[model samples]
Target chain A: MISPREILETINMISNENLDIRTVTLGISLRDCVHPDIEIASRQVYEKITRIACDLVKTGEEIERDFGIPIINKRIAVTPISIIGESSRGDMAQIALAMDRAAAELGVNFIGGYGALVHKGYTEGDRRLILSIPEVLARTKHVCASVNIATTKAGINMDAVAQMGFIIKQTAELTAESSSIGCAKLVVFANAPEDNPFMAGAFHGIGEPECVINVGVSGPGVVHSALKKLSPEADFSQVAELIKKTAFKITRMGQLVANEASRRLGIPFGVVDLSLAPTPVIGDSVAHILEQMGLEKCGTHGTTAALALLNDAVKKGGIMASSHVGGLSGAFIPVSEDAGMIDAVRCGALSLDKLEAMTCVCSVGLDMIPVPGDTSEHTISAIIADEAAIGVTNNKTTAVRIIPVQGKKAGDPVEFGGLLGGGVVMPVSNYSSSIFAQRGGRIPAPIHSLRN
Target chain B: MRAVITVIGTDKIGIIAGVSTILAEAGVNILDITQTTMQELFTMIMLVDISKAVVSFEHLSGRLSAKGDEMGLKIKIQHEDIFKSMHEI
Candidate 1:
């Protein structure tokens, strides 16, 4: 029989690899809280979100303390305001403001679903919600927006895609004085999954129950440690097996946490997103995992293949362990948050071009990347457009979270510290795409546009 | 007669393309193929019609096993109806 301490050590080894419960997102549907009267709807929205999400942070914290592991983010995702606002006679902006106030009052870091899901066709309310995003996000502190433009079964929604391309540009323009970073809080997706607990794409869909609890798990450090233990002479196949076993163990922990948390919270447990979500920690870098795999640096010739293997292994392990696995469950390469990634940029081992290529195989795109302060808004919009195109074309979820640090040059370090990580501002090629970004109409959906 | 070929074991180079080429050369028409790799483990399902082929199921399995030895892939050929019944649940 295995000794309990040894089993515990194995558990610790698995948990320590970038593995921790990623997010314990409480989904609260605000549709029932709506009223024909604007003030009543706003008040109801506030009361419902606050009531349902009341124990979210405390419960997550208690679980972390009991389990002796970290729960990185405690968040809330509400039903898409576009859907709720449709039944209300009040202004959609008022609903957004109320939602923002509720999130702040509840002390949650971010509240998702301040946008629309117009994959095939847009409703009047969705159009309003789309147009109101720039104002809603700019005026509010922590409201994140997302728009689903396509899905595999439904094909691609070109009209929504085109509108979103323009909306991103407009949102950037509206927030340009503040580094045009509001667009960073938005995501465009193809098959936008229902139970994704991560943001800024998380939203409570109409198909979901009244309330539920979902957890996202991360463990890049654990995977890296496993890879590090392998002999330097080990070939790629060995490396792949190690990653799969590590991911299997890590995902098992996630399933446990999700089940325990859901049981404690008295709500149905949602999926465990087996994403390698990184923090601002020194040892917990996905880039470091690649380096440990014998790459002189990340963002090189073998990067895509490496990412593909990691992504596939993670999904396979997680899917086998739980029927509830969902969310963006793959390796993440957020630039600013991972130390090895920061160093890679500082040493020129990584670049925007390589980052884009890697995103095709990873979970998210261009996340937390810091560009030069002086980079043009049009250029930022262009980058968002490019990333969105990849997600739409390939039928995956991708997002951009770029920060243009004020007065920061390309090589200078900006320390957001804590979970945001520190990073050297990366240089975007000086080439300007202002004219194209400024054209601002949606790129019509691909000919395969099917989802309505 | 229709047949279902199940490939299992480690994923290496040229599993599907190699097996498909042999089936094609034998005048087998593939109807559907699904494959997934988990770490070193690989699983594949191929639905094909071998009624026009010049060989029996045992003969085809024998040939595939020989090729499987060469490529380190395990290939099992079964009747399509039997496979469907076994897998329906």
Candidate 2:
């Protein structure tokens, strides 16, 4: 029999701490769903996704009940639509509609992969997909989109980056009535992972098998609570060690769920993403974890070093527990989705610049940020370019999911509701970057690409 | 096939008897039980073999939960592997 103490600890983590399996994402390949006629292609795409993911939610619920662990989301990701849409002659929005309809029918919360990959350059299919993203996102409720504009081997695609800046602006405007909610559903990436279980950045890479089950586990509250019991005089090394130990236990839960889900679904188990993803709920904030590390507040001077230690320790401990660790497997500091981060921003302890610097050491980049509605598209593009450069040079995954809420100014609040949460708009730099963004050519690949 | 059911609430008479009755009805055999009173709170951990349970896992959990609510307690039944995987190598 399991020890009584261990049973109580696990139960306490669930009932008190906000520990949960963030998502059980099923990746389905749509490479075989292509047809010359857009209508036929769309139908095949919808049918394939629906058939593959039909039991996803039910199975997730069953496991959640039996195991007594909350599985927050049952999601589906597919092969990037740009590849499958190459042979189709219909508008890209039609495919988005099909994906949306399939998601609704299958009862999944979000269906990712309505996206394009153009790290080096754009194919005709990639171009059409990128161009249709704004309208597609505005039209579909459950469909998520992502565009990869940079890779370590392929430099930055400035043209695509520039295009995305405008696309994000348009997406925001199109969904302005809903607090520019469309931008929240779209992600722009550098070195985007093909098997990421989290969104709005997940998409089944072409190299993945026909279908796979990937799990993303999150427990920032649990980590924070553990840290609270430690002595304040504990050094950074001690802090890192404690965090690593906590992360090992968290990742173990993910691996267990991934194996169970894979066995029950008869699909290959992909990877367990050990990300300390935070929610707006109190005690669940990654920023609070940083604060527990002796910082007066998040976004202060020592914040970056603290986050770096946290992110590194989390990965080190997680890798030892899981056979395969992938995806954005580190700390996520999305402004709106974390209560500590929101408070930090509201109290002037956190800023967009500080958040950008912190992203250099964490998982996702500049996530769930809301700037003034009047912020120029070129500025947003420049922000994406800056973040892309960081990822490209460092050879890591980074993404931007900023919402420029229309009719809102800095310090004003935009209520997106639900898990997206509400946040006060953070001010952006007033400086103009229109000239640099107007340069439409690719930034050449780094010298390291000459490895061959 | 085995689960750990935990009951936490204020100390009360007949709490163990009531829980044991529910498990017997579902054909779940109690393997071990540990009970303690810390301050005014009563915490009980029962390891039960549910391999021969007559009802579904969900149904058994629901019945136990309803019984717990009636007794002003919080009862949770979770698979044992959840603890083993977390606390054990």
Candidate 3:
């Protein structure tokens, strides 16, 4: 029999500390849904997703009831729509609507993979997908879009980066009535993970199985509570040990849930994404974990080092907990979705420059930041260029999901509501990067990539 | 299916009587139980086998929860695997 102390601890973590399985993402490959006729292809995409993911939400609920754990989201990730719609000749936005309808019918929070991969360069299909993003995102509420414009081996596609700047601005403009909410659903990535269970960057990669189950686990508050018990004099290694052990317990729960979900759904289990994803609610912010590490606030001088320790220890602890761990397995620092980060931004303790530096050691970069409304498209492009450069240089995945709130300036409070949260807009550099962005071409692969 | 049932609140009489009645009516057999007081609050942990429960797991859970609410206690029932997996490996 399990000891009472252990059982009580698990229950306390769930009821008080916000430990829960973040998402049970169903990855459905849409490679076979391609056709020259756009209508037929769209129908096939909708049918396949509905048929496969029909039980996703219901099953997740059942699991939640039995285990007494909250499964916050049941989402779907399909093959990148650019590849799925490559041979189709009509407006690709129709497919976006089809996916949105499927999500509505099946009752999933979001359906990702309205995306393209133009890391080296764009094909005609990729170009059309990129161009249609603003309208498609404006129209579809559940569909998400991501474009991979850079990779370590392929360097950066300066043209795609430049184009995305305009697309993001246009998305914001189209959804301006809703606080530029459309831009919140789109992410631009360098070295995007195919098996990511998180959004707005999740997509079922071409190499994945026809159908698989991936889980993303979250528990920043649990880590924060654990660290609060540590003595102030606890050294860095002790801190790391505590974090790693806490992460192990958390990921072990993730592994159990992933395996159970896979077994119940009769789908192959892919991986457990060991990420400390944050929510807008109090007590669940990753920044609080950093502050618990003795920093007065997040994004201080020692913030990067604190984040690096957390990210690496999480990965290290989680790796041994599960047999297969993949996806962006580290701490996420999305500004709008975290209360501590929102406070940090409002208090001026955190800056875009400092956030960018923090991303070098974290899982993803430049996530969920709302810039000034009048921020230029060229500057957005240059921002993507900088993030891409970091990913390429560091050989790690980095992404940008910045929203240029229409008619809003720095320090203005912006509310996106629900899980998206609200935060004050942060200012960006006024210096123009238009000329640099206009110089379009591919940035060649790094010299270190030749080792293969 | 086996599950862990926990009842916690102010240490007082009739808490055990109320919880045990609900479990007995649901045809659940308590396999093991331990009780203690922490921070001036009563905590009881019960390991129960519910495979032969007369009602659905959800229905039993709701009944137990409502009973807890009536008694001014925080009660929860979770599958045994959750505790084992987190603590064992």
Tens-place lDDT per residue, model 1, B1-89, is: 67667676787788888998889777888988777654456777777788899765556777887888888877766554322221222
What are the lDDT scores of the predictions, listed in order?
0.75, 0.92, 0.94
Q: Residue A285 in candidate 2 has what lDDT?
A: 93
Q: List ranges where model 2 is wrong by over 4 Å.
A: B38-40
lDDT of candidate 3 over A1-452, digit per residue (tens): 88878888898899999999999999999999999999999999999999998889989999999999999999999999999898999999999999999999999979999999999999999999999999999999999999999999999999999999999999999999999999999999999998999999999999999999999999999999999999999999999999999999999999999999999999999999999999998999999999989899898999999999999999988999998998899999999999999999999999999999999999999999999999999999999999999999999999999999999999999999888898999999988899999899999989997877
Candidates sorted by lDDT, descending order?
Answer: 3, 2, 1
Question: What are the candidates' individual DockQ scores?
Answer: 0.01, 0.84, 0.89
- Interface RMSD for candidate 2 relative to the native interface: 1.0
Model 1 stretches astray by more than 4 angstroms: A8-11, A14-18, A87-91, A150-184, A373-378, A404-409, A429-452, B1-89
Of the two candidates 1 and 3, the one with more favorable DockQ, higher being better, is: 3
Best by DockQ: 3
For residues A1-452, what per-residue lDDT tens digits would candidate 1 score against the true structure? Answer: 22223333443453345457778898888888767787888889889998888877887776654344567788989888888887767578888788889889888888898868876678988987888887877788778898876554554555565566566656656666665557667777666777789887899988889988888878888888878889999988888888877777667667766876788889898778888887767668888888887788887778778888888877876676665877788988888778888888888989999999998988878888877667776676667667877877776877666766656778887776556667788888798876776664446566665646
Ranking by DockQ: 3, 2, 1
Report the error of model 1 at residue A90, Å. 4.8
